[model samples]
Target: MLTSIKSFFSNELFNTEKGSTADSSEHQLQLACAALLIEVAVIDQEFDTRELQALITILQTKFNLSAEECETLRTLAQSESEDSTSMYQFTQLVNSACSPEQKFELIKGMWTIAYADGDLDKYEEYIVRKVSELIYVSHSEFIRAKLAARP
Candidate 1:
């Protein structure tokens, strides 16, 4: 089943708008950003309450969203993160569209999420570092944010 999904995604026939079910750019961005956070939180497979709260906090502050809006995005992001076969689709979109500063902010946000529990797990560190590199965040800046975000 996974192979088939990958094949379908990789095929040229899947390139069109009709090829996949989800085509909403805005929705995809939200899902991608949120899911990436969730993914990092779950990289350790702990998915603790602190991480969840941190995710909600990040969403609320960054989007300037109300509680309802925060929950909506969180739910959508969680659903996608749980089911996603790959994180690249969303990361690629963010990389192409967001500014350098925004990318740096995202790295900061990822660090914030990782430190929500007051302890930085190995998996969380690995995930955020990898994601920071992918998003073009400098190593020093990434380290600084990670340290600052630490509880």
Candidate 2:
């Protein structure tokens, strides 16, 4: 009963050069990013359709995932966000693997998911703030992302 990394990426399954089951760094990173957005959207105990669509939008544009691929990842990420206890695993991986600019972009995505319901839920705000800190996004940049993602 483990949440395998490959499951986070997709059920389609991919193999490495040696033919053993494996996920590339690129897929792993994108999964982490997607998982965080899922976490934020579900934080208020409501996985709104708007939030799901916002996540799909972010995943598609940010990771260049096809619409089909984005839906696959979104389904997998939702499972992870619900099954996992903390956001630390995803946030830690993202912080260590991505550049500052990338982290800022992630913050922006989180903000978008948070605001998808047309209002900033307090718990959603709290989750985004914690994620920004976990991913090393500066306070200034975090605030800027919040403002920019307001819709």
Q: What lDDT does each candidate get?
A: 0.74, 0.81
Instruction: Give candidate 2 misplaced runs (Cα > 4 Å).
Output: 1-4, 7-23
The TM-scores of all predictions, comma-separated, are 0.78, 0.87
Lowest-lDDT window of 10 residues in candidate 2?
13-22
* Tens-place lDDT digits, model 2, residues 2-121: 347554344464334422333466677777788898888988999888988899989989977789878877876777777888888798889778998889889999999999988789
* TM-score top scorer: 2
Model 1 TM-score (2 dp) = 0.78
| Model 1 lDDT, residue 114, Cα | 86
Among all candidates shown, the one with the greatest lDDT = 2
Q: Compose the digit string of candidate 1's lDDT tens values, residues 46-85.
A: 8889889989888778756677767766776777677878
